[model samples]
Target: MTLKNFKVLGILLLLLAVFAVGGKKVSAAVEDRDVQYTIGVVVYNQNSPEMNMFMNYYREYIQQGFPVKFYFSGSINSAEDEINFIRAMKLQGVSGIISFYGQDIQKIVEACDEEEMYYVLGSGSISDEDYDKVKTSPYFLGSVGPDAKADYEAGYNMADYFADADTSSYIVLTGGSSAGNYMHLQRTIGVLEGLAEKEGLTYSEDVEKLASSEKTTVVDAGKDNVSITICPGYMTDPKGINNLKHAFVDRNYDAVLCTFNVDEIMKTITSKEEEQGSNIKVGAVDCFSMENHDEINDNDSFGNPKIDYIAGKYASMGGPAFAILYNAMSGHPEANTDDADSNTVRLYQGFWSASDKDTFNELYGYTQDIYENAYSCADLMKVIKAYSTDTTPDDLKALTEAYTVEDVQKRIEEN
Candidate 1:
């Protein structure tokens, strides 16, 4: 070939290379970079399956192959202790926080605001008053988890499972239904309302106050000699452990309807169920994991799965929550908060109900604790405004609502 022809070929290749690099630069997203964004995970308990799966999902979602890191705090109670923890996180170069703490959300936000950092609630929600106050703040990125309506339905459905049992005795293992816990309050009320409607009984007592009573109380069966013992407190502390044992020993109820994930707690008394030869049906709001899977598969003396009804969420549901906080820190503070008045991201995530072992096994595909949940790092990146500009808060809501066991199964099959 001639020298002129060879030179022309070289020039053509150089132009193509320039165009390729330019194309890459134009599509740059923050997720492509090696950025470090430290997030704080505020938890009530470090050992519970719910909390463990929750943090596991957040870690796999936000920490894997992204410019993000998570700094978890030990059990935080009052706002004062949490505020102090936030101060400590700031010194570690933490950029933002995702809190599962339920108490004094306003105070937690206030502390974040003071630190000049971004904040997001991993689960549960802020009060209407609290949302109105902090919704406009650039630092406050809104909240998620079941609201009062959802909580009520979750509890109602749990009790409704045993509606036709015709059992005269029932023991309710209420978790945190004590005063100041709105989630448990709504759940307890729903349980009572549902049990009454289906059990052919009438209740005139102030059951609503049972939510905020902060103590265990006996709900009047009202008719047919039914004794509904409302047992509050979990299976952890001494008082709570004693309460659990006493409820089983004293009430000898035929069924247990719990508002929280009581799979482990219930396992504590399987021997008692055997000794009494009780065919107790169990329902709880729990998580989608093998530990729970095993419990759902376990049978009592009557060959019934320890737990038959579960109103639960997948571990990966917490991913979008981190995405919201990351967006705020990315300067797209208005990415969510579709409402003009609230200016806060208010989204609802419903539960995945597994009424039987077959349903749970079909819904939850994992056989072990190495839970590679449905939402992968790539899926989580979709809601990240920095990565996907067109992604809206509405998208997060829809994703959360639709992330069912079937959804997980479909994702696994497709991949």
Candidate 2:
């Protein structure tokens, strides 16, 4: 061969060798991440940004890196729906389940136990009564969620914002508290307690009584007589919607504390604020949806941000939850428990709040798909037992507790 041809051949040979080595490495990586376990994810709604982000973390992010496949059971609310989903997943030979269904956990746990599927509470608490029954079950892995205190504080702080500003008149959306929703009960209490602390109004501490109170039950706040009508259910309840409409039309509420689903009344409140000159403020607990995100930045006719307070959660908050389940399913069950005597775990997560546009926009990237997710495989490796040997439940607990927007931002920046 000519010298020039030989030189070109050598260069081509070197490139071929480099490509071969790179291909082998990529193939090996794919082999290492081959699916070995199927995890069924139970959620109440599939349409919201919260659920979208949540499912994305598992299906797109986690599944891309781990030997896990996620099967989502879209929009299961009741015990029957949960039972049916669990049975179907069992028949599909799913190795485990991550349930977001808070209602009737005991039944769900028992159903999971029957199927011998490892179970975890993806979010929400296991009630004290239910906890006692399933805390020792072999199939019950553990739980991570915003506990009652977190829910209450979400309510309290939101209500406190309006109350501290001397906004006496208010309407409270009880979400599902009347239907025995645990999270709603706590938030409802927080709103009432927060208002009481600010306005010196007396209220029944008994959650059940408050949950069942007749609509338009007036709580006497010394000077203005703060009257709050608890609209029992959320949207889709014709009677509840009627009561809510009545409350809005009949009374001039200065603010509304929506413990769940702010969008339910956002339109009405905004229109009232703009057209009727109603100086109504809003605070609520919900996911970081774009429409609401904009409300945090967009001003109304009165030059005030439409949404004043939002106790929110980013989808990455659910990352460590999968980490916990991963440990349990991967033969490191010891790392899933907290107390030595208890077989189950309870990890509390915090909320990300935004009261103004700057505050909301500052943390906006975290909820969006772009921000290096806090619970990415590398980030979770710090807690995953197989990846980080000697990683304890405490490490996972710390991660769950550090789920606030500020903490997540600090973590992302630090990383």
Candidate 3:
């Protein structure tokens, strides 16, 4: 009687174990283990606050479900290095990538095509030529950044504001080695054009032609009743900085127009002011740093500090990048492309000067907060969930439905 009972119990236990294992297998099947996708972010450097923020946002959103890893080149200085790094990263086990450097974009695109992976540019707009090349490729998503020409125009607006005040003859300090040269030149052209329309202004016809030439050169784009001294300051070169500072003193320029790192520019301006007492007005594109405020020598052409007049930046960039990435990954196929020309990305157009602590803090606060939260993987996923179905550039705009610079600004204002 005891043996029979033991045998029956064993059989029942075996059957129960079998059922449990089968149930586990069924659950695993639903979860889809075979599809372990990953995103590889190829950035120039991890140390820069901007890069850190971009990666953080990507990682934050990706960690929720998608596997994301970072592949960064220490501090790439040339196009070749960037290309190699991207090529190597493509070989890694990643389904997609978001590349940051501009110099090696073509190479990166080619590599991505070879690897059969999806990609997008995180910052810096692409050229029409590049756009034409990737127009039909599924592997090439699109770029998420301000139009370089537009940024230049915004910067030129600062210059125009200064020129209107009769403060002519300026020096321009543009950022990003060769890549940055084009935008800075474009803004310079805009400044020249704006100046030409004003009374007593003279412009050089060579300005447009010079700006467009392969060799980066300085030229007056238009004739104005005023004289504008143009000096080219390379953003990354210390020699270029010193030369620009010297040009400011030598020419007694009315203003200093900068389109790159505000901190570095401030240092150049401060050194000149302290050493030579040059009263050059400082005008620029994008937000100014705290250091710039402490060191500003004069009110901008607009009566506010030049840095304070940054229009539609914080939300324009961070907000859209998050929106686009989300749409792309979540399945809105077209979220990455900016074909609409509607500034769906929030751009802040305001300025800060040393005289107004409130204004300075307000703009800085907004920009910083965006850097902190906007491009995260979660927000990105939200956009993707809504827009991932888009299969064309026209469809991408639909994914930007949830956010606006004003939305981001509102959050900043409330906080």
Measured by TM-score, the strongest candidate is: 2
lDDT by residue for model 1 (1-415), tens: 6574465445434433533654411121245355557666777665667777777665544465467766566656688767766666666566887777847777777777778877777777667888777776767777877778888888888778778666667777777777456787788888888888878667666768655555667776677677788888766667877887876666567777888778557665576677687777778877776578778888877888888788877666777787778777777765666665544687777677878888788666531223345665666667778888898777777765556666766655665
Model 3 TM-score, 2 decimals: 0.66
Tens digits of per-residue lDDT for model 2, 1-415: 7674465456444433543654411122234347677778877776655666577667666777777777676566688777776666666567888877747777877877877888888766776778888887888877888888888888888877887766767888887787767788888888877877887776644545775554645554445566665666766568777777777677677787888867666777876666556678888888666667777778777888888888867667778778888887888877766666765888888687887778777666665554466555777888888888988878877887788666776778778
List the global CA lDDT of all models.
Answer: 0.70, 0.73, 0.50
Q: Which regions in candidate 2 have their CA more than 4 angstroms from the true location?
A: 1-33, 202-208, 225-227, 301-303, 338-342, 369-371
RMSD of each: 13.5, 12.5, 14.0
Candidate 1 runs further than 4 Å off: 1-35, 210-216, 338-343, 366-374, 403-415
Write the residue-wise lDDT of candidate 3 on 337-391 in tens digits: 5544321222222222222445655544544443333233333444454524434
- Put the candidates in lDDT order, highest first: 2, 1, 3
lDDT of 1 at 21: 52
**Model 3: how far residue 205 lies from native, Å:** 4.1
Off by over 4 Å in 3: 1-38, 45-71, 90-92, 164-166, 174-180, 209-227, 287-312, 322-357, 370-381, 386-415
TM-score against truth, every candidate: 0.83, 0.84, 0.66
